[model samples]
Target: MTSRSAPDRLLSVLAAFDHAHPALTLTDISRRAGLTLTTAHRLVGELARWGALERDASGTYHVGLRLWELAALAPRGPALRQVALPYLEDLYEATHENVQLAVRDGGEVVYTEWLSGRSSVGVHIRVGARWPLHATGVGLALLAHGDPGFQEEYCAGPLASFTPYTITEPELLRRTLAEVRRSGVAVSDRQVTPDALSVAAPVRGPDGTVTAAVSVVVPHSGARVPALTPALRLAARGISRALGWHPPTPVPAEDT
Candidate 1:
């Protein structure tokens, strides 16, 4: 096998930890990163000393708080979360459901913020979690506003299905996107999980381009799509305006 660069090797050590393996011993890191024991030890020490990784009392390493501080500086990460948090809170207060803000990263949506109410339905989502664009309301909202060429290409093939309701056919997905555009909202009906339903709306930037999406998830058994849609759209627009988006002013009819 070709030797990895120093930077690549170091990054692999950190990448060894994920949602499933949030903490690992030095030997575990070595095996997961495909490096020798000595190399893993050296890289892990360097990262721990630099505050990018933290070693617990059990000798297992996890991502450090310092990395979180750096992540906060990402424009599409914490920076956007800081702007949309208030509106998200308001939406949660109004519906007492699970409120989420997500941004599209390629063909997937990365959830940036989530607000859960006491009575909210159980949803298996956390900050930084990713889901395909065809399986969630927030994902659908972002996909509908994405570039037409990219949307067409994404709809072409290889769409993953999480549940029976997930849109796997290209033509049906195309129609769904068109409906999202016309209705100004996207509804995900048990696409991700059979018991969950979501309603989402696009959040625009200063240039009036959709840069993110916001949604509310509730139990599908007693879902109220009509009752929830208005609140979700209002919260999304509130966040978009906070991000400097101005609704296009209607042009007056020209005198004949």
Candidate 2:
């Protein structure tokens, strides 16, 4: 730790906090960050002073609001959410179910926004939550639209299985991606959990690249994919439009 660069050491402290471990005591931070107690203290104090972290009355440290302020500046985070919220809200209103918007980060999809009604189906999801690219609807949508070579590489790698229905076979996953591209939507049925179904559509940026995804999660028992597809696609399309995407015009057919 002492020999590492200053930026790496500081980032290590911040990286210790995550969705699973949002609060950490000084000792916990030291051990998790692989830093000495004195080094942890000095860095924590500096971070708290800079408003990157906060120390509570009990002395536990938490990610501070300043980080959120900075995260809002990310183009794929708050900027995308700001434009997608209304459409997400509309989708939520249509089904009164769980609506989500996410962007891909390497092999995972990071949720940027989520909307759930009081009676929405329970899902293992929250804002800032992450899941592998082959497990969830938004993940599959993003993965299918990603670079072709990367998609093939990802399929060749091992896939984590959360339920019996999760696609663990690489060939099946390849076929799934082809279907997603063909249909312009992705359905993840009982993949993440035994009783949740997710239908997702891709969102495009100004360059017509797949930049993000929108999804609606509902109970698998009575999931109506046909009913949900239109609304979900509408929300995705609205967000894409707001992001300045224009569908490509078809070329004129040539005479024989």
Candidate 3:
């Protein structure tokens, strides 16, 4: 067997913790990281000293605040969230619905910010939660604006289904994406959950490429899709403008 490098071994110990396993014992880290107890102990000590991991009173370790501090510096992650937050807050105030901002990562959409409204539908999404591109309104907006080749490849995938309403067929998903592009909005009708629906619009960058998506989730039973579309699109455009995107100016007409 090939030997793992020092950096790989160190990263493995840190990677042992995830959304599912947020804390771990020394033995658990050693097992999950495929390292010896002694090696795991050494690495964990270094990481703790560097503030990359923190140990609890029970001797279990969790990812530390230092990592979050570093992650905040990423332009596509927390930086984008900082720029989009005011617009998200405004949308939340206007609709009192669950407002979210997400960016596409591979075949999944990683939610960067979420504001829960007092009377919003029950959604289990956290800031870092991820969902497949075919299941959520934000995901559909992003997928619809993605590169043509990548979109084609994603539409041919083994799409995972969350609720009965989730689009599982490739052809149907393709059609839905087309409609999203034509209408400048995407609707996830009880797709993620049977009781919740979402309306989403694309957020573009200065280069006119889709960088993120914004959405509002409401109860599916009485969802006002048409009513929510304008607000969602307006908020998305505001965020895009904040990120240096401007709608193209029309060319002047020639002499008649």
Candidate 4:
């Protein structure tokens, strides 16, 4: 293992536990983070004392509520989620489908909120689940509006395939992103799950930058993408306006 500075090593131990590996013993954490068991124990003790991690009765540790509370302060995470939630609720009431809100985190999308659909299509995605930027509709919407360098790096595959329709080819993925930009929305039809489809639109910030995305997931069979598109777009635009986005003024034809 490469030698990391003490602070870096400690932070790595904390980073090792995410949505995938939420529960870990000291040994598991040490191995996953490439840290010595003693170092893991020391760092874990400190984190536990500070309430960043919680130790279970079985001696496993998971992220604590305190950490979740701290993450709430991040404007791009829970803060945005809180503001968009009412509109998300309205969309869910309208469609009775799975509603999700997510933001770009590195080359992946981190889900901040999820509302279960009554039909229950076997999608197990949770509040903190992450998926590649090229596969999920929310991820695509966020990535399409991201910085050029970040977008280029993300499009360089190692793209994961969840279903047959997932865009694993770089060229196809590139085309799909371009389309998202042009249409101001994204549709992932059975890309993440074979039976489910998702339609997503970008949520903008005060400065008009895409900060997050909202999506509705429904069964792919007999799906009406056209009908869902308008609802999703309206929800996204409502959230964007709530964040203070205003369209630029149009000049009158007489002025020309």
Quality of model 2 by C-alpha lDDT: 0.91
Please provide, for model 3 over 1-256, each residue's C-alpha lDDT reduced to its tens digit, 9 standing for 90 to 100: 0388999999999999989999999999999999999999999999999999999999999999998799999998999999999999999999989999999999999999999986678888998999999999999999999999999999998999989999999999999999998888999998999999999999999998999999999999989998998898889989999999987667212100
Q: After aligning candidate 2 to the native by TM-score, how far in Å is the CA of 113 from where it should be?
A: 0.9
Task: List the pairs of residues colliding in candidate 3.
Answer: none
Candidate 2 lDDT score at position 78: 89
Best by lDDT: 3
Off by over 4 Å in 3: 251-256
Better by lDDT, candidate 3 or 1: 3
Residue range 2-117, candidate 2, lDDT tens digits: 58999999999999998789999999999999999999999999999989999999999999989879989998888889999889988988899999999999999999999976
TM match of model 3 to true structure: 0.95
What overall lDDT goes with each candidate model?
A: 0.92, 0.91, 0.93, 0.88
Candidate 1, RMSD to the unseen true structure: 3.1
TM, every model: 0.95, 0.94, 0.95, 0.85
Instruction: Give lDDT tens digits, candidate 4, residues 68-152.
Output: 8898898877788889999999999999989999998888899999888878566788887888888899999999999988888
1 or 2, greater by lDDT: 1
Candidate 1 at residue 111, lDDT? 96
In model 1, the clashing pairs are none
Clashing pairs in 2: none
